[model samples]
Target: DRLKEFPCRIEYLSRLKSASQQREICEALKAGKIDIVIGTHALLRDSVRFKDLGLLIVDEEQKFGVSAKEKLKALSRQVDTLTLTATPIPRTLQFSLMGARDMSIIRTPPPNRYPISTMVSVFDEQLVAHAIREELARGGQVFFVHNEVNKLPQLHAMLLRNLPTVRCAVAHGQMRPSEIEEVMLDFMAGDYDVLLCTSIVESGLDIPNANTIIINNGHRFGLSDLHQLRGRVGRTNRKAYCYIFTPPLDVLTPEARRRVAAIEEFSDLGSGIQISMQDLDIRGAGNLLGAEQSGFIVDLGMETYQKILDDAIRELKYGEFSELYGDELSNEGEWVRAQDCQVETDLDVALPESFVRSATDRIAIYREIDLLQDESALNQFEKSLEDRFGHLPERVKSLLTIPPMRWKAASVGVEKLQLKGGRLSLHFMSPGDSPYYGSQTFAKVQGQLSRYAHACRVRQMEDHLRVDVDGVQTVGEAMTFLDYLSNG
Candidate 1:
């Protein structure tokens, strides 16, 4: 209505429509008559196509199926796409981190918004009645979500019988759209004190007058669903309350119990992201690339599956996509460096026998040096060595430097460190497409690359960053250069 030129048509795609109605919408879409279409799963049908499609935006993307997502992805490959989701599933988040897709997160909450007060317990009539009376006294409405339609009447009757003066209404997916609209409109107008319904009110209903939500058997709902269901209230500045009633703790399944705990624990203003991750953990992630549905982490196990995936990706980039990736797929070193950061050097990195005298004592000191973890420990070891064997020799000092170099390299994501051939080389982790490239560590390394600009040479090795620097002929020189490059 606000836009002057492009006509927007919001089609009701929830239920099946007549063939003529579908054809009319489809024709309008194909002919570029409709500029915007706010629809449901029906819009993903084969019959729907847009003329001169330039942008695609997907909201609540986690609710869609794998095949539907694939279709959206295909559209995205051709046009600009912006996916919006309050709660993203674990697999989707992982793929974004792996650089399969770009992602942005909005962590800030709305101004003057209050966190919902969530509590969980077994069903108790007295408690429910008290909660309703409290909200009503404040001139606010209440939402009693009993998801089962058949059991809704019994609960409605109980509410009516107990609180005869309180006006109440029920709405669910089974009800006609017009009927649901009438009931919702009446409730919004304050015609009713309570709206008892199913999960239909999870999205798009923004009635600030409703500040309290009571979810019966909330354990049956997934973590994301529970978050959205509880989200029906607390739309305004008024403080909101969420009561989640479930069966006895012993009776509920392990996953159900975990879900309830997570919902109750994370009732903050911006807890949707955490809730989705909890959902993923409670109910394992599905196959990401394939069309398989959720909860496949049980098969082959997550660790083993990830190992296979890493190997396959590395192999593809090295063999099949070698020419396509060019310098980015230079070698398989990226995969190897992901595990350990080692500094290999041609110079002898050990204490001199003349300095230590006893070979037994030298070996003992070597073992102790290997056990050093931090700079503090290294300092203490250096002091002990100095006290035992007069002043420290250059070789001993260089040997001591290697430990901190490894620590610095590991912190900045360097997997393999080499100090041979009078030049030092650092190999970063794989895949080059990983989100780590854009991280602060990578940025810091880039800034220091300009310090030794003349002596340093960089390469794009299999989607990973590799840097080689000359003029570092000694072990001490190598450690100082590494500290400057990684820590600077």
Candidate 2:
């Protein structure tokens, strides 16, 4: 329809065509006569050339191989390139999230779209027959996806025998390209009531009338693959159904179970982002920076690796931390390191299972607390906990108090705070070179310590100021003492 308005020459190249035909298309593209050329990875070959290519578009970018994508990227260096995919690869998604590339998401589904009713169950012949019959009665089609091509014929036979009146066809990658295309075209024309096929229908095939999909051994598929296959049925307005037939739950591996569960959990509209994140957790972030960095991530753990990356990014964007700390950052691991506020205590500072029962939710809250860098963030975290989990328990409240205590201690050049053996020890950072040195605040702290000489012992070491708690015995008393020192 769009071609009628423009005076343009277009050529189509594919592996299914003869070499002579492909050569002709290439010649037309090189001569600038072809305004648009559409093909598979064949267009990425060295023989292909364009006279003045102004735009490049790759659909289902996640489906391309790394080498093919690299070649496409090289071609798009100075041209306007647009990549589209329902499920983006982790590396590409990370690039977009990190602001390395512009991204736009389409969350609104087309009119009349409904969430697919997904079911994960063991393979039962009666269940499969019932599902196919129901869709057939509604004048709709069905997609029976079996991953093994060799077993497709047996499954097709079984389906036909179960439903003698239903017309069933088979399609798979092992078949000839012409045969696959014919089977797909027939299915689209409603010639076949059910198309028993392999994963070839995983991409670029949209059948609105085929609203029922039954995947044999669905546990063998990845999360993204399962999601994309389920997507084939839910593209239209009518309600869709997806039956993931697998072995019993106990027989599946832990990772396989997680993948299936994640797919089933995120079946809402615009759940692609959540699905991608779940995929990342199931399949460790694959070579986001490079293959070499993956080893560092595996060795140091993801949380510690992310901390290092965050520090490096901060250093690059906002100069070195030493610039802010007056060379104290460079002296890290020497006298006293910058931003290292150690908290050693014997108090119960864990979230009790009775309060937050779910381990996943507790870990999420712990991560949020670990990320708090200021008082405002701490306040917000407290408010969120209250809103979600009701009034905080005593232990949880104590857990919340620790971050601000560490922040205050760091602000006043206190390197370590130990509250153990019925005594409290405060070790301040090196004098004269510290930010708190030579300031009125330091003098005020000294005077305050002197006033409590009977309750506290203050002594100046070569590199640090040591304060020993002589009167504080309980955690409450120690907290009160530390609060006084912090406030003054």
Candidate 3:
């Protein structure tokens, strides 16, 4: 029997046929004939039951409705349920963040990931032709993104006029479902050089040869939507390119500018993912803890909110550890708002809301953050924060580590070192030095040693390049640091 293929001796139940067939399948499952089965919601009718059911797997958890989720959860009492999802929604992320569920983040991007090259510019017919020619030279495909469905035909005609030799197709949601599917298949089969579509191309479409995307009028889409649409390309090892075309400058809204800027800044791999992750984190915080908690994050600021979350998690689960000193637990730092939180201060500085509201500004902000590594820029930054927040948060202080006389004896890969009164601490990220792993590399015995020195600091010294931080401080002054950091 096919049931044997499941490595079991149970009957098979399927509801792909008529209502009567579904009823029979449910009856079979209820009668203890089927041990492992797969079917749609039709099999979830109340009349169905299970005898000695031990495991259940719900594929594509996001596809299920709330009522269906409740019914599925009820099954959890008798069966260990495994809910699977590639891209989970806000509610699911919230459940994972809270203690309601356990999760494992698959942060390892696909193995063949080559950084996506992104460019933002006004619509240039020549650039369009060049981008298409480049992809064609590499024997690759292209995704010409003209998001407005009503103008899709006109856009398709324009593409045909410019890249006349390259076969092209159009796909949009307004078309018949079957037609959309056929066009997508045709694109995949290499029958078309470009697939001009809306955001409908945003998910679950993998075309390895397609490495170039030109999103026309990209200013209209949100940062997350733009990120997802760009993700449709760059599925191969080749360097993918994304051109986000925006409307003219004078006509552009501040919000539109921000969107385009974000697209430009997030043209790289890890960068775009980080933007998406931060968005998810903010949404998750809001959904699980209530909108009031979300507002609190705005009041406290992003880094402060993260500190609070880390503290809350530690207090509830691990309690205050003996190794962590009381004075070391204090918060001392200045706060600059991250993308997740927004605050208004009595200064000319643009608040974090500016970043959250517009993609163009977000990208510009990121680029600016990247430039904060220079010593002169860092000095200028201290002044800027002081000017913006009125006063730097006393709780926030930077950890300045000077290498010992003997660099070799200083231990390998020592990223940070700090001294508080007579106590000294080293901050490094090595599996061999991990306290959690019980592989403490340094054998130094002192009165009070701590590794929390890396809690929040602005910059890290490097041989060739510097790692910049917008704002950071020692954990000891964390709270006071937050008060100043946030208000500043």
Candidate 4:
């Protein structure tokens, strides 16, 4: 019924195919006879040509290298490429953030799905038997990932001795592809209780009956790799478990400890994005513009790098991309305006612990506030807060005023704004004499300073121009004065 509804020819091509079969498939693809074709990296072979391929969907993209993807793009540069992964790589985030790609987030999970229950523990034979037996008792199978090929046999022997009632099979990349496929087929057919293999099982295997995976020395795997392996299970509505065994924290390196903890902590549905973000945070932002997607991001320091990047992106939007994306660039939200600009105020600006008790919630709220672009959005946010957390405290109300003040200060080319001891100061660009002086906003600011008389004063600092004003007692007062200074 499904095939009839679609009404297109479909074929599978892989290394398992004979020469003639592959040739036939390639010919069909080249002649536009095949409507849908699914296969391994075998599809990427140059022999497999396509006639005006309109769409290319690559799943588990983190497993593919950059050059391979580039070659795929070379086949059809105009092809609408969709790369799918549970854990997005750092490179993917970089491109999406740099305006090179569009990103759509699918936070909703499929119906009848269950989040995997994940854990990190020191390796012990007893724990292994318990996890395996638990799955078996529930009429499910298990995947035991022992990455070291040589050690796999010893572990398999030990498992057999400990859990003699369980039927187990060994599969690894060192074996012939045919043998591995047969073993996988048997495991899926309920011929084996556990498939003890290398991480090769991370891909091209979908058996909903396998609801648990045990990884030996999971600390050795990369963050994304661990995610993919855990994802091998939990395919059905049945609950799943991923036991990541690692060396004890006392013996493991700090980096390995973090990697282990991260996978264990993110077991909820849609945790792939969170794991990727944690990976980025643990590994810095990486070399954004280069193929080396991680490491050495600490060179310029994140704040400095962000400032330079913001300036560069703005310059690109106005200089190079202006001709092509003028409308879009001009329509970008409040983030672009306030981004490169830093706001420094002496006022006590914190989500008082009394308001939001949990430190984590307070931090998340602070981050959300920082992203809000303008006053209207912030006013709406204030209403939501009041609705959720009773009346807004005086400090909470004061905290809401910073966003608009920062946006206004940025528009006038003030890199920093400081309100200290009832005195407000707007610090202009470093090396004061820049194109900012030629902008209409700066002209309006200058007109306001002169018109306001004793309320405002301008001082020439060594690297920047500082505009000082009086009568700013609270954040609200500071925001009011800033609005008047920017426009009045």
Leading candidate by TM-score? 4
Model 3 clash count equals 33
TM-score of each: 0.68, 0.73, 0.52, 0.86
With a 3 Å backbone cut-off (N, CA, C), the pairs that clash in candidate 1 are: 328-462, 432-463
Model 4 stretches astray by more than 4 angstroms: 1-5, 284-289, 298-304, 315-338, 348-404, 429-440, 459-465
lDDT of 4 by residue, 191-284 (tens): 9999999999987688999999999999889999999999899999999999989888989887788788889888888888888876765666
**Model 3, span 71-170: residue lDDT tens:** 8878777678787655454466555655579876555677878878888888998899999999899899999888778898888788888887989888
Backbone clash count for every predicted candidate, in the order shown: 2, 0, 33, 0
Error of model 3, residue 334, in angstroms: 25
| Clashing residue pairs, backbone N/CA/C < 3 A, model 4 | none
Clashing pairs for model 2 are none
Those runs of model 1 whose alpha carbons end farther than 4 Å from true positions after fitting are 1-23, 296-312, 319-323, 330-337, 340-488
Q: In angstroms, give how far residue 416 of model 2 lies from its true place.
A: 8.8
Better of 1 and 3 by lDDT: 1
C-alpha lDDT score of every prediction, in listed order: 0.81, 0.79, 0.58, 0.81
- Higher-scoring candidate on TM-score, 2 or 3: 2
Q: What are the RMSD figures for all models against the true structure?
A: 12.0, 6.4, 14.0, 3.9
Off by over 4 Å in 2: 1-11, 16-18, 96-103, 288-301, 308-349, 357-488
Q: Model 2: per-residue lDDT, tens digit, 360-440?
A: 999998888877898888888899899998989989988888887776666656778887778888898654345445555
